[model samples]
Target: MKNTSALFIIDDVIANQLLELDDEYIGYQVLHEESFYKHLLDVQEFPVIDEYSNKESHKALLVIRSWQEVREILKEVQKEKNINAWKRLFPCQLYADGAYGEDTIIQNLSCAERLLIRAVQEQKYVMFYC
Candidate 1:
């Protein structure tokens, strides 16, 4: 099996909650626009790492609407860095609004988590964006 980690650009409150929920299983790291940009420039590459088996590692990116621009930026990074395999995961619903509808943010998170788990089990490198 391949090991995996997650990078989040979300607010501290949500990031902290996610960390608490899966501290042992999922590796968590914070990602900010400035820092991420700096890293990308410094490394002259996208923020990616090799996990188990020295193969492509699963990477998940969590960001809010304010930072949604990163989505397109990452696509460029992927192309420049030659990342052929990656999955983009995102929140199916908006959590900021009081849309206490059936499609809750938690449900989306759970579903994404499940998909990630499966991808890891299958030794696939996935890039989840939310």
Candidate 2:
């Protein structure tokens, strides 16, 4: 498995799941408004860019806005990365509050999958995800 460092700007639920999936993976959880702003500042400066990591390690930045927007963003990011098969190696979810809880989240994910497939077919990178 490729080891990667990922940055997630998500809610408590998604962040908890990600941590549970991999204890070794280091990341920050921005669940509050102040923390979110702080995270944006950090991203602009790119503090983690110089941090040490292995060649196989991958770094990702996940920003979870609203439930609807998060899915759109994820689809874009997946397209940009050209990722397929939904491998657990780089598992990260941008989750937010939707009407139907997990069901809505899953539906959103399906949309992201479709976008991913289209991106793969066209060999195009979605710019907003970056």
The estimated TM-scores of all candidates read: 0.23, 0.26
lDDT assessment of candidate 2: 0.33
> In candidate 1, which residue ranges exceed 4 Å CA deviation?
1-103
lDDT by residue (tens digit), candidate 2, 33-82: 45333432111111121222232234334322333443454554543243
Question: Top TM-score: which candidate number?
Answer: 2
The 0-to-1 C-alpha lDDT of every candidate, in the order given, reads: 0.33, 0.33
lDDT of 1 at 49: 23
Candidate 1 Cα deviation (angstroms), residue 99: 4.4
How many clashes show up in model 1? 3
What are the per-residue Cα lDDT tens digits for candidate 1 across 31-125? 33344323221111122222111332333433332233333434443322332222233333223335333334333334444444444344333
**C-alpha lDDT (0 to 100) for residue 21 of candidate 1:** 52
For model 2, what is the error of residue 61's alpha carbon versus the real structure, in angstroms, after optimal superposition? 7.4
Candidate 1: residue pairs that collide: 87-127, 89-128, 89-129
Candidate 2, poorest ten consecutive residues by summed lDDT: 41-50
